[model samples]
Every structure is written in structure tokens, then in C-alpha cells.
Target chain A: MKKHRTSPTTDSRYKPARPFNADEFGRVRRILGGKVLFVQGDAAVAYGALLAGCRFFAGYPITPATETSEILSQLMPRVGGVCIQMEDEIASVGAIIGASRAGVKSMTATSGPGFSLMQENIGYAAMTETPCVIVDVQRSGPSTGQPTEGAQGDIMQAKWGSHGDYELIALSPSTVQECLDLTIEAFNLSETYGIPVILLTDGIIGHMREKVVLPEFEEIELTWRREPTKPKEEFQPFLVDSTKIPEMAIFGTGYHTYITGLTHSETGYPATDSQVDHHRLVQRLCDKIRDNRDRIVQVERDYSDGDKDTIGIVSYGVTSRSVNSAVKMLRQDGLKIDHLRLVTNWPFPEKEVAELSERANRIVVPELNLGQVYHGVREAVAGRSEVIPLWKTGGEMHVPHDIVELVKGGVK
Target chain B: MIVRFAGFGGQGIVVSSYIIGKSAVLDGKKAIQNQAYGSESRGGECRGDVVIANEEIYELEPTNYDVLVAMTQPAYEAFVPLLKPGGTLILDSDLVVTDKKLEPKKIKKHAIPATDIAFKKFGRKIVANMIILGYMNTLLSPVSESALEKAISESVPKGTEKMNLEAMREGIRLAREGKG
Candidate 1:
């Protein structure tokens, strides 16, 4: 029998420091003074999460979103953080929520089916007011419709996936660079509002490779949840301060805090049956985001010199790319048109949409799903302008010619 | 510049476009690369599209290719129509046989025996992608030759750098001599 020697590398518990040179990890590079990197959007999110001081990641592997976890698994350890591959999506979100409560930034990523599994725990995080980031890389699904294809079918689901009347922040990123930038913003928003921020991306943006210029480490902005200013005895975890957001007490800091999914009072005690208390609690939760809509919503707009013939196009995520190209092609033909690309999907920019509706002769909404955001556009426009929806499904993205032709037909 | 690379799944079709896109980025240009393919791991038709520009690239997918790199017959047949008028077409002469009568008018064509050269010179067909990249560099100048070579050395698998570089150099020589 041949003698087998066990190398140190054979030990499963032993992780090599700096597994490869920084240059070898094509996923990201910050050396040589801000050089560009060609990386997938998923990898960019992972880098963004790392840069935003996210110290804990618990994720269950799923298609399209798995790369995010894989990159984080390799990176978190190198940065003195921890990444766990949980048993299921529920446990994944649960673990991150726990980590967040322990005074660390945490996150979880999943696709449509896995996101479905995480809904209840996401609600738990919401009720407890834990700050954590959840990434839903949307794919075709009512229930596991297409595993490997791309779709923006979860725009509404991101807002209402959990039960109850609560508000959360959802951002849609179209480019690889935006994937990095918006993920940092998502974490900041979550930390700022004490709500779970959703980085809602599609399979195309999640899996596609593009050139990204990563900001320097010192240039990145990071925010943390507001901590209690009062003493441990007087600290109220759910008290609505003047900021409309409650301050959180760390779990092991000698503060007596009660955290529950039940409707709770300002002192963090469960008030299961009191309607007035329930009303106040839920209203505060919703109002924290609602009152700050001006600061929360981000939209990119381009107008066509007040041309009467110009139409307004509203799009987000991958569909925004096609809409942009279509607008350019139409403009080359002297057909005036403008576009509003929604970077923040939820806390919908109704005011901006209404303004565009008032200006343009017609408003065109294009998306990968069958008229999800279009409904919101129509509601915002409210018969002021014709809201035409160009919807496509079944994993194929809208070609530029199709969108341009639709606009042309409308113009005619 | 919008470029498309198409071939069978195992031809490193995605990697070729990826390296080119990375090269452009290293040269301080914006580039985006997207790919589509069937479920099969090796035999399915694979295609990749890359766009490089001085400004931000808003179009995620290419509408009309400025350059088309077709490494197989099926790829040439499928993508030739999508090439812009007067665009450049790069072909693997050993794999793609063009019908002159059916070819699009006014488009410049540069055909090279990239696969044959990779197999004959380096004894590995996988390096054909690097050869095509080298040939493409001579035609389009999408990125500098040094930038592409740097991207290749960083992208390919370990220990195969020598063979891949040799293949690329051979391709550049063929293009320079008008031997393809």
C-alpha cells in the first residue's frame, strides 16, 4: 500500500490567507490606484457589501444569486468577517438578522424561490426593526418558472412579499458599476432607516460581465444604525424619538430589551390586542420611510428640449438599457423623446412620474414582466397622458428595434 | 465599438470577448460584455457581444455589431446579417467557409486559420481564442496589443500562458503577412 501524506491544505478547517494574489482575483482589484476591473455584477455587489462594512453574510446558494455568496464566502474571511452557508433561505435570513442585532452589518442574497422561503423571516426582521440587507436577484417565476433565465418579475413582490403594512427600500441597478454603487447605498439606507433594504436585480444584470471603476476604500460612505443615547435602564428599543426612527440597543449591552414579531409597544413589550398601540407602531414604521420619500427616491431623467412630439419613457433594471438605446435611435431620426430610469424602485417616484406625464404627450413603460411597474405609472399619470406598456416575458429581453417601433407606432 | 464573438460552446467564445472587454477597460475605455447560449456545456451554439466606448455604455446588448468574429460555420451564418454595413468580419478559415454570393456587400473580411494554427503550432485547439484575439487586434485596434496580451496572461489558466502567447504571436504574424 502506498503511504499517503496529509498536507496542511487537506484540512477542511484550515483556510489559506490570501488564497491568490489580489491581481489573480479578476472579480475585484483596487491596487495600482483605482484601475478598472472586468467583473460580473454579482461580484460587484459582493465587493460593495464588503466595502460597506458588512461583517456577516448568511446565504443559501441559488441560481443567479449564488455567485454573490461565493464571492462573499471568499472575501468575508479575508477581511476578518464571517460568511455562513445556511441550511435554507429561512435560516439564512434569520442568521443575518441575528448578526445585525449583535451590532454588525449583515446581509443575505437569494433568487425568486429562495426569496419566497425567506419572506416570513424578512417580516420578522421588519417587525423587530433590525437593519440588514437582502438581495433578491429576480428571475422568471410564479414558482420556479425558469431557473437560468432573466426576468424583472419581482418588482411588486419586493415591496409586498412579506405580510402586513410595512414599508421598505428597494433599489434597482442596471449596470455593473451601479450594482456596486447601489449595493452600498442599499446598506446605508437599511442602516439609516432600521429597515431591510432590498437590492432587487435581475439575472441579466446579476450575471453579465462589465467594466467597473471601483471607488477607493476611503471614498466609500458607510452608515450604522442609530444607538440609544439614554442609559441602559431608560433605553427603549421601540420608542419613537423625534427622528421618527427608534434607536436600537445592542443585544449584550446590559440593556433589557424585548424583541418580538408581535405588535409591540414603544418599550418593546408585546401589545397583541391593543388596536391603538398597534396602529401607532405600524404607522411609525411606515411613516419613517414615507416622510423621507424625497431623500429616498432616486430617478435619472433626460428630457427632449420641450419638444411637443416627444414621449416620456419610464424603465428600470435591464430594460432601462434597451429603452436608452431606443431613445437614442429615435433621436437620430429627429423623433424627440425622453426617459426616466428609476434607480429606487419602491417609495416610487410618483411626483416625478406625474411631472413627466404633465409634460409629455404620452408616457411609455417598458419592463421584462407583464405590466407590473406600468400599473404604478398609469396610476401616477392618472389619465393625464397615455401610459403605453411594452411588456415582454419568457426570458427574452426587449430588443431596441421593438421599443423604437412601439414608440414610432404610438407617434403615428 | 460593438463586437460579437460566436462559435460552439467549448471554443472559449465567452472568454475571448471577455478578454477584449477587459483590455478596453485597462485602456481607460468603457466596455460591456454579455453572452447567450443553450443549456449544453460544450456542443451548444455560444455567442458573446462586447461594446467599448469613450462614454458610458447605455446599451447592454449590441444592436448592430461593428465587428463580428465568427469561429464556426453556424456562427458565421447566424451573425453575418446582424453586422453593420461596411463592418469588419473576422473568420476562422479552417472552420467557416463563406459563400461569396451570399455574403453581405461592402463589409471587409479577414479570414485566418486560427484553429489550424493553434493545433499545428501549439498542439492545443483551446488557444485558438487567443489567436483570434491577436488577429482581431491587428484589424480593429479596439485595445492596444500590449493591453490585450496583459489581459490574456491574466485570464487564461495557469501554466498555459506560454502556449497561448505563442499562438497569439503566430496570429499577429499571419495577419501582418496577409497569409490568412
Candidate 2:
């Protein structure tokens, strides 16, 4: 478990995103000193990428998540980076992974349908251990159920979206501020672990606005993939060195690295031989994330005491925001309760959540999806506490008042 | 506070809500504005909602709206039930002629001659939305005049800022000033 740190550091709280200027480094370094700006959830997703130093974004237009792509389209280009609206979502993901291999921070965004289309590429990125970020602004539907709606249905898809056994990093933001911070974190984890990071958001949080104090564009730190200082011939793209990360170099950079969707060795050439390289490659792919859960996993608990006297609410994304408001309302009405709003959906903050669930009267999981996070909550607590699932489908976000009713033992 | 504004095509209803929305943003309040106008070049029925509060607002749609501003009869009739008890309902008296069924005491319906004032007084019917926004400011008083002026100045593209600001002021005067 690696140490986890999040942003919009206290200093950035009071700062607004300023235009580019001189003395920016010192000013921004000091400015991230105050309160964090509040913005809508999707804006936060877009901001997270911006803060993470993501310079390359290729995405196709899709609802809900389109705002994330649109904001990047405007901001990335102005910052001397490239933002391309590709022909479709698959091409968008393909471009992002390709750009990431080129040693630049890159990301692509989409909704549920587009997300489904990107799964094949997601598996390829996993097998190849390519580093990048994918933002899925979840909507309601198995297939275009609701365009102008919101849903947490993609929660399971994000984890299992790409077909594979490899663990992933999927952070769901309930507010715009988290979007900004988590986007940066997504990039960081992607680079750090050598895997594609998913920043999951529902339509409600993605499209809604909240007060966000964005540090000037240049003020935020961005991490690009580390390039090979070693000569091209000496580089092993999938080398099983101690660091578990290769000195990545892009194809056009004179690195001459072989690229493929097939299983390959450290040298980048496709090989069917499992004894020498294939086994090591797959293990490293999984180890990259499994080994760094702490640094990669991010979660937050508000009023989570885990007492039997209190019925706890577990939720993420927009549901978490509603739960926060509902908890406040319930408390005012004299109902004792606790709320755990998950910022990171995958990597399931097991230890902390398990500890909290042990003593709580009940753990009620509410989400825009049918019952994705509830599965993790149930497995984590191991039935120590009652695991109730409050699932919502389509795009309508589960309101806070509804959560209050559930907390009082109204419905699961 | 959740505020919903509805009107017909080219009624400046979206523009009116934007003026209020931008003013809130200028005042540094946590504000969010969402518009649902038709994709058609010519609008059939267009509507938008603005949510502003000291704390974070989760609901996107106006729930028990604090204020309702409408430009056409359909706009007023559609939004009447949504008004919270004791909420303020402002409309373009000249444009909205239909009698909508709404609780008179619970909801205060105040109609101002927005089109008449814009066309007859300013000789520019296009500024009717700004006029309605101006009148809205007088009744709601949620945002400061300086902030609204600043908001209008920046929000309305560079060339049209000055005229829109004046139209806003005139609209405010029309609604705020006492009966002659």
C-alpha cells in the first residue's frame, strides 16, 4: 500500500484559476495554500485531468461525459497541448493509449455506450500495461436508455468493463472539486502503476456545477510518463526490473519499440512463449496496481464512526453528495447516522471500510447503478453488518431525501 | 435558491435567466445554470433553471422554486404548480394573456409590461428579456446592482454589453418604481 495524497491543497482553496503569468511557479506553489474551489462534478473530473498535467486528450462527443471532453477541448489546446475530437470513442481510447505510450499524459472520455465500445482497447491497455486515464460519465441504459439522464450502472462495467483479471483504479467523484483533484490523481496513479485509470462519474455530478476554486492552469502539477534515459537498444518495454515500470518511449521518438495488442516480452515483440515472458508480463500488469493500493486507492468518510447505534450509508458519485446532505438533514431531525462517500470506487478501500462496517448497525449502499458498490460492501464487511442495496437505474440521481428515508430503515 | 425561467422562442427567457445567473456568479455565490432549449433553429418551448445557494445544491431542476419568471402564457401555465408557497412569480404581462390557475395568496403573481416597455420605451423589443431580468432583480433582490451590471457587461458579448445594461436598468425602473 503506497501513501495516498490528494490536492487542491489548503492553499488552492482560495485561489481562482488565473490566466498564465510570470512568477507563476512561486505564486501557484504558495497559492495552493488556501481553500479549494467548488465546481460541478463533471467539471471536477475535467479539472482533475487538468491538474494532473494531462497534456493530450482525444475524445468523441458523448453526453454527460461530453462536458469533461468539451472543457478539456477548450483548456488543453490553450495550454499548448492537443485536444482532438476523434471519430468515435474507440478511436478516442486508442488515441489516448497511443499518446500515453508516446510519453505524454493522455486521456479519453465517454458515456455508458461508448464505454462498452472501448472495453476491447481497455483489455489491450491492461495486457500491455499502458498508462493513461479513461473517464466514463455514466448514463442510464443497457443501450442508450437515457441520454439526458444519470446512472451509476457503469460502476460494475468500469471494474469489469475491460475484460481481464487485472485490478484497476476507478475513482468516482460526487462533486466538481473531487473531479479536479481525482483527475490529477488518476493521471498520477496511471503513470505510477503503469495502468489505465478510470475516473467514473454519473450524469448528475458530471453536468452539475459546484463552487470550485481552480488553481490557475499552470499552477497545478502534471506528471508525464518517464522516458528512457537508456539507449533505445538497451530498453525492455516490459522489463521485469525491480521498479515494475519500464523507461517508456514512444514510436516516433526513435525508440524503435515494437507495439502490439498481443502478449509480448520486455522487448515489445509479440511472442507466444509463456515460459520466458508472457507469465511475467501478466503478473507485472496485475502487480502494478495490486502492489500500490494505498497510493492508488483514495476514499473519504464523513461522520463514519461505525457504531451499532448508527445505521451507516455507503455511496459514491452523486449518491454520496445526496447522502451527505441527507445525513445532515437526518441528523437535524434527531436521527443518528453516518455516511461514507467513496471518491475511489475500485481498489475498494477494504481495510478502512471493513473496520468501519464492523461496528455499524447497518451499511446501506445507495448508487445510481442497480447494485455495483453494494457487492464490494458486502464482501468487505463479510456480513458483519447488514448490507442493504438501494439501487437506481436510468439517469435520475437518487435524491438525499430518499437516502434519509432509507437510513431510517424505510427501504434497502 | 432554485429559479426556473420559461418562455417561447426569441423571448429572451434564456437571456433573462442568464443575467440573474451571471450576477450570482459575480457575487461569488455557488451558482449553476442549465438550459434546455430546443435543438431546432426556431424554438417551440424553451426553458432553463438556475440554482444558487450558500451551500452546495444537488438538485438540478427547480424543486419548490423560490422564484418563477415566464415570458409566454405557456411558460406561466406550465410553471405555476412548481412555485413554493409564498414564492414570487414574475411574468411579461403583455405577452402572457392566459389566466393560469394558481393559488393567488400562496404564490404572488406580478406581471410587468416587458414587451411594451422594451418596444415602446426603448424601441427595441429584443431587449425584453433584459427588461424582465431587471424587473426580476427589483422583486427578488438576490444579487447586487453592481454585480448584475458587471455580469451583463461581460456576459452579453462585447458589442452588445452597453445596450443590454441600459435595458436592464430600464427594466428594473419599470418594475421597481411606484405607479404614476
* Top candidate by TM-score: 1
lDDT of 2 by residue, A1-412 (tens): 1222232222121122222244533343243333444345666776656555567999989877777777777777655679999998889899988888776778888898999999989988877778889988888888988886888888788888776577778988766666776777687667666678888877776766555666554555444455666787777766655667665667687876776877787778888767656677777777766666666565665653334566778777777766767878887887657666677777787776786676676888887777778888888988788888887775566677777787787854
- TM-scores of all candidate predictions against the true structure: 0.89, 0.89
How well is each residue in A1-412 modelled by candidate 1, as lDDT tens digits? 1112111111122122113333333233442124567998898899888777787999999988999999888888877789999999999999999999998889999999999998898889888999899999989998989987889999898889899999998999988888988888888788888899999988988888887777754455556776777898788889876668888778998887789999998888899999999998898889988988877888887777864556889999889888878888988998778788888899888988888887787888999998899999999989988889898988878988889988887442
Candidate 1 wrong stretches, greater than 4 Å? A1-34, A307-310, B38-44, B73-77, B80-87, B96-109
Candidates' C-alpha lDDT: 0.84, 0.72
For model 2 the local lDDT of residue A310 reads: 68
Q: How much is A410 displaced in model 2, in angstroms? A: 1.9
Query: Can you write out model 2's per-residue Cα lDDT over B1-180, one digit (the tens) per residue?
Result: 778888876777665566666678668876777666665535678876777777766665445688888778778888777788888888878777646455445677778787887888778888888887777777778788888887677667778877888888887787668411
Recovery fraction of native interface contacts for candidate 2:
0.31
The TM-score that candidate 2 achieves is: 0.89
